[model samples]
Target chain A: MTQTKIDGRAKTREIKRKANLNLLERLYLPEIFKGLSITFRQIFKPKFTFEYPDVKWQPPASFRGRPVLVVDDETGVERCVACGLCARVCPALAIEVVADETELDKERYPKKFEINMLRCIYCGLCEEVCPEEAIVMSKEYELVFTSREEAIFGKDKLLTPASKLKDRLEFLRKMR
Target chain B: MESILIAILKAIIFILLFLTFSAVLTYVERRISAFIQDRLGPNRVGPFGLFQPIADVVKIIFKEEIIPANADRTLHTLAPIISLFVAYSVFAVLPIGEKLVIDGKEIKLVLADVNVGFLYILALSSLGVYGVTLSGWSSNNKYSLLGALRASAQMISYELSLGLSLVGVVLVSGSIQIDEIIRSQANVWNIFYQPVGFIIFLVSVFAETNRLPFDLPEAEPELVAGYHTEYSGMKFGAFYLAEYTNIITASLLVTAFFLGGWYFPFVDIYSGLNPNLSAILQVIVFFGKASLIIFLFMLVRWTLPRFRYDQLMRLGWQVLLPLALLNVLVTGLVKILL
Candidate 1:
């Protein structure tokens, strides 16, 4: 037969230990002085408060902002080349593209492209899957709009100047 | 008519002083608590946060007031006013310094030198419970009601011990007048004579003011916001102001009764000094005693863990009450024997 276990003694010992701890806390004289000393020290210390609006906190270095499709400034044409990679990789199914034949290059180009930013997860997956290096994530955090329809960016809102990145970096540095 | 006018002027000055002290106490409480915790407190508002209380006042005044629809409007409004008024009223008889003569006439620092000043303070302190109770009841919230009940019960229970503890002092002084008691304590001080009574009184005062280690009613983790749960803006500020004023008043009463008010030890050695200089020295001594008591009160507030509701009640009824009675009985017996 297996040896019978006796848990009662172990439990009793644990209870006894807890009881002693309680008694020690109650009887300790230095503990009282230590507690009082904390309040006394805090009395003359400066309060931590920041006046908002006039003094805004700079966002963390790695903070991700709104995603945007990049355009080549010299070419001044559609850089997407109807790759369909962004639409496939999008987790929220927010990006859509319609392919059509272009007159200049005779290559399939996007006739209708739309990104429902309200549904966009901003995970940078769209930028990751781009083969032509057309789309890149932007650092525009202040993305407020009056209406939901206005928030859904089409080809028009996605087409931002390439030099906008240099200006954004400087602005972020100045905020720091 | 002239006497009445002078009395009004004195009262106004006293109220202003009390208000100023109460406000400064807020700053002191935060700074002292911070220092004990090994951190710097509010020092940015003004030099060493001297104007922090004023800034707090402005913020509270400007904050949008929110009144709950279910709350009893009249009682909710009246509660804080009652608390502040009672707290302020206790200082009317509190002597900050002895009388002085500018040209010929003697002017007392105190607003009133009433014979029943001790009783007046006791009565007003008891009255402070009404504000907590009413605020809790009027809020139509369960937590508020519970907090109110705890506060009222704690105050009422401790008050018996508090009043009894002081009986030893009153008996020895043979007068209910605070001024008379202080004058009697000039030579020896009541602390030496009635040590047990003084301890009981100090404990009971902590309970009476609903301060830390005795602050069951406003236990933040358990009760959320406690008695003034629904109060907002200036209303909440009133309760805060009342609390600090009550603390200052408790300090003043302790100094006057136990530490020998306005009396410096071995001052007779300076007999050759001018009478005016002596009076100034006495005033300094009185304020010094008061400051020590205030600092001790703040220290104790941070040191002890708040008693559980049952423990608080047990201490008040079983421990302190019995001890106060015994102190009084022993004092009475000693007086008779001597």
Candidate 2:
């Protein structure tokens, strides 16, 4: 700490005063005119603007949007075994899952799973806590709902086929 | 009887043209500002939102006229009227063309041929301060009063420089009439000789008209819509319209004073055209010159940041006033020497 303070003091000593403006420059009027000239040129420069609504922005696969339940392709069933892990992990209390008995391979399946889009913080915590990789973040970000009822995304809204979520699954696999 | 008809025609033409121009400017200002910020502005109203101003007018007309319970209703109503009146009235003295000949009677392009037109313009613009001050005072809000004070202060400070700057033009041209000033510039434009005067006059008009870089009166962040805070509906629209109309008038004045109104260089070659055609061409040239200056006004608004209230005051009193006085002195000395 003592050596660092000495070095800092020596460095401060090397600092030089900035050059002052000449009398003409000090007048400020000419420099303002120069600044105006620059901005005038900017008006003709190529603008980077989108015709939004007509042309949508396509976010990358790595983009974390609304969390969705992954539907297994071969089995034709939601991979969420109604483990209730997502509900427990949701910081916003946005997720609600009710487990029911299933005859096929898994003993438990979610009879009712709901995620309140309004309450959802888009933290991806629910997606991360999924034990079976059942839920993952999907890039379908542009959400519009006038009513609260419409905003509460149920299984109909939440479920995405594993084929559609290949990129996110692969990314997760790579990370793991 | 024919001259009366001609005067009426001029009035109708002037009113219709300015209103349309002011309306078009609303759309243009939005589009230009949007481009500056790299965003696509209102393109949904009509094709490229060309009809946006019409929609805006409709909306403003339909909006409820709200008067604050504790506010001065009479003064509040009167303020916008006064502002609109002053704005429309100033165009009376401005000459846009040479003359129009129809049925053997030639009509002067200007609505009124007042001898002291320039002085009238200066006087009327000074009175415009009342409208802003009344609007602020009547609003019964602290912010409104503050905005009113700032606006009145700004107008008063700049009015001196605005009047002083034009004195050099008056001295050189040897006439206070707007028409005579333009007529005198036929040989050589006043801008060549009075460049400093033109600069001072130009900057002063920006402040006088309450344009950006000098728009502390309605500084969005500080004062919520300035003196017109409590105004609603058409009253608010009137003040907004008045501001834009003032811009056109200022541009016209600039064209008249320095740019040689309706007098383009080497125009004698084209003087052989049909007399009516020549007059029409001169009118076109005048408007063309005015439009260029108006474009500069809008460009400067987007380019420069607003001056601080103190800096604005300092500029009016310190820089522009001294420069304008010097220009007048030089012009006076040159007149005597020559």
Candidate 3:
């Protein structure tokens, strides 16, 4: 503790010494003027920025984006088997599942699945944990709105129909 | 009736001038700092975002003015008005542009050619602390009161050095009138002769204005919103306006004292020009110097971190006060000897 206090005072004196040096430098003024000149030049230089909304930026291929549930095209239904794997894998405890025995060929499916997007850490472990090729993480990142209800992606919001997979895949392909 | 009309016109001109300059200074302070820090600031509104100030004005005008129920109603309303008035009134003594000749009748550049212009400026500027202090105290909040106390003490402490630093100029020029001081520096600017006094004066101005590096009163992390914690809408805007006006006033004073007012660099070449043209040139030159000084203020703000309240007080009492006094003493001796 004594050593830290001594070190702090020493640092302060060093700072004062530097300040004196700066004062000496300002006595010449030309050196400071030169620095100002460089800043003035860069002030007018064209800024490097891309237009957003109209032109979306493409992130790297390994970039994880929004999470979505996969659908079976041949069966014309969701591929999820009500296994509760997604809920278990989510580190944030963001995902919740409510499975029920449905009349879709008597296979069990989620009756009421809810994922709180605010709590979601976007870990993509949900996709990895799904037994049947049911969940997939897509590259659709710009998700924002006013209401809390809108932010929470339910089973209806998470389950991207089979028809939309082709468009999502095309966007992903173009990003590369 | 004619004198009253002229006086009314003069008041109108000065008030409009102060408000307009303060508005534009808000834009300039932001833009200049951004430039120094290598970033573009406010370039999306009007051409180069010149209308950003106008947009700010509109926003402030339409904003909901909130008054806390527990707060003192009269002082809360009066605080910003007092700040705005004191700040705005100081500009009457400040000469902005070149003298104009209308119908061969010569009119001076300054709004009011007060004989004791320097004293007027110092006295009015000191009054600005009251507005800040009252707002803070009347808020019935501890943070606001603390901020106000810091502000009042800081302004009062710095006012001494600020006044003393300029004492050297008053001693050398032998005139409290700003125009006369400008006239004294017609040959060589006072800055060249009394650089130490100028430096001391600049530092004190920074402290007195409660700007960055001396902005301990409103240190956002420490004091939250400071004295204006409960202020909103035009009340908040008034506080902001007062600050910008103070900056402009400091810049003008610096220009009038250190830099020759409206005196162009190559006046020898322009000496052959018509008297009217010469005056116009001088006005532009004056404003150019003031603008550069304002730019420097913005630059230093971005470059330096704020001083702690204790450090600022110590610097004022221990360092700047003595230095300013010494400058006056030395200048006096030199004036007597020479």
The top-ranked prediction according to DockQ is 2
Worst 10 residues of 3 chain B by lDDT: B262-271
Given candidate 2, what's the lDDT at residue A30?
Answer: 89
Displacement of the residue B97 alpha carbon in candidate 3, Å: 4.0
Candidate 1 lDDT tens digits, B229-296: 88899999999989888888887888898888877764543356665666677667776777788889
Which regions of candidate 1 deviate over 4 angstroms? Answer: A1-30, A38-176, B27-52, B55-77, B171-175, B184-189, B192-195, B233-236, B263-303, B329-338
RMSD of each: 6.5, 3.3, 5.4
How many clashing residue pairs appear in each of the predictions shown? Answer: 29, 0, 1
Better of 2 and 3 by DockQ: 2
Off by over 4 Å in 2: A1-19, B265-270
For residue B49, give model 2's deviation from the true position in Å: 1.7
- Against the native complex, each candidate's DockQ, computed on alpha carbons, is 0.29, 0.48, 0.26
Assess the local accuracy of residue B9 in candidate 3 as a C-alpha lDDT between 0 and 100: 82
Ranking by DockQ: 2, 1, 3
**Which rank order by TM-score, best down to worst?**
2, 3, 1
TM-score of every prediction relative to native: 0.73, 0.93, 0.81
User: Whose TM-score is greatest here?
Assistant: 2
Instruction: List where candidate 3 sits over 4 angstroms from the true fold.
Output: A1-55, A69-84, A87-121, A131-134, A144-176, B35-39, B266-270
TM-score of chain B of 2: 0.96
Per-residue lDDT, model 3, residue B77, is 92
